[model samples]
Each structure stands twice: as structure tokens, then as C-alpha cells.
Target: MASIPPAMAPSTANWHWKNKNVTTWAKTWFERELPTISVQDDGNEVSVSEVVDVDGDVELGQRKSKYVPPMY
Candidate 1:
């Protein structure tokens, strides 16, 4: 896939004739953003958490909850 120009974006409305086809465009935008990712703990103390797919944009502002350690 070719690189996107400054004017064109991968949205519903396509400007150039090359971006009219949505089938091939899907593969062109194969990326994994950090917003739709998360970390989960499997009831372990010294284990690393796994990042899961949450979908959609992630909130960048404010925290909703507090952190609590299993052992303190």
C-alpha cells in the first residue's frame, strides 16, 4: 500500500480516484493503536498483564478509579 497524502484521509468521503475502493483500503490501514488496548492481571503478584482489545477511542483525560495493591 502506498502512503497517504496530506490532503486525503481514510474516511467515508474519498477525494482521489485511487481511494474509491474500500476493499483494498482496509489492508492499507493495518495498525494497532494504543487507545483500544488495556492491561489485565490474572490474579498474580509478579506476573505481567496482557493488553486486550477494547475498541473505539480511549479517554485521554481524567481517571475514574484508584489503584489498590493486593499486598501492602
Candidate 2:
């Protein structure tokens, strides 16, 4: 009797779109596009309307940005 081959493990490897990691590209795009899309909040009260700071590791695919709302 012929032995059946071991079933292939299911993974993203077969997924065509998953082959390419877009995280780096996406992060770059955001950095480039953020300024163009950002709007200034010129209101009477102080508010956080823009990205004050961005800190993260591109290699680790980690990012951190903070935006604090106006206290009412």
C-alpha cells in the first residue's frame, strides 16, 4: 500500500499578498503623507491637532505616537 504524504502545514507562505512585507513601505508612506493630510487647529482653546512626536523602531516594525486631547 502506498503511504500518503504528510499534509503541508497551513501558512501565509502560500498567500500571494503575504509574500511581501509592506510594513516598511506603509511606514514610509505615512511619514510622507502625514504632513500633507494634517490640519492645523486654530481655535480659541489649546488642542492637539498635529503629530507632535513619533518614536519607534522601523526594523522591529514598532511605532509610537501620542496625541492628547484638550482638557475640558
Candidate 3:
């Protein structure tokens, strides 16, 4: 898998992770951009201002993975 880095490296520290699998996955996942999709609420039509979280970091930051694997 050329897209995948040839190594598994952990960020942060050992003390931060109780589960090694999750920590390892996080490292790999962090190297890619997460997808961003926008969908309307199926039940209602809400204004952008009504749903936006201006104060939260979740609204401010982006996901890592730039591509989606073809198998997906």
C-alpha cells in the first residue's frame, strides 16, 4: 500500500493511551484527511445560523485524510 506510510508510529505518549490498538490507529489515521460532507436534516429545514457551532473547536478544525480508498 503505497498510500500507507511504511511504518507505524505513535504520537503523544504511552501514558495517554490505555489501548495500544486505538493509539496506533490514531497515528495512521492522523496522516490522512477526514472527509467532509454536508447533509440537511431529514426531518427539518434549518438555517445555517441555527446549527452552526461557532464557539466549538469541532467547527473550526478539519479531518486529516485527503483521499478515500477505492475499496471503500
Report the poorest 10 consecutive residues by lDDT, candidate 3: 54-63
lDDT of 3 by residue, 1-72 (tens): 315323324345433322212333443343432323234687765332222222311111111322222231
Clashing pairs in 3: 32-64, 32-65, 33-64, 33-65, 33-66, 34-63, 34-64, 34-65
**Could you tell me which 10 consecutive residues in candidate 2 have the lowest summed lDDT?**
59-68
What TM-score quantifies how close candidate 1 is to the native fold?
0.18
Give the winner by TM-score: 2
Q: Estimate each model's TM-score.
A: 0.18, 0.30, 0.18
lDDT of 3 at 64: 35
lDDT of 2 at 47: 34
Using lDDT as the measure, the top candidate is 2
Q: Residue 13: error of model 1 in Å?
A: 16
lDDT of 2 by residue, 1-72 (tens): 223223234454443222223445445555555655534476544433454555553321111222222233
lDDT for residue 32 in candidate 1, whole number 0-100: 29
lDDT of each: 0.33, 0.39, 0.31
lDDT ranking, high to low:
2, 1, 3
**Candidate 3, after superposition: displacement of residue 45 in Å?**
31
Candidate 2 regions exceeding 4 Å error are 1-17, 39-72
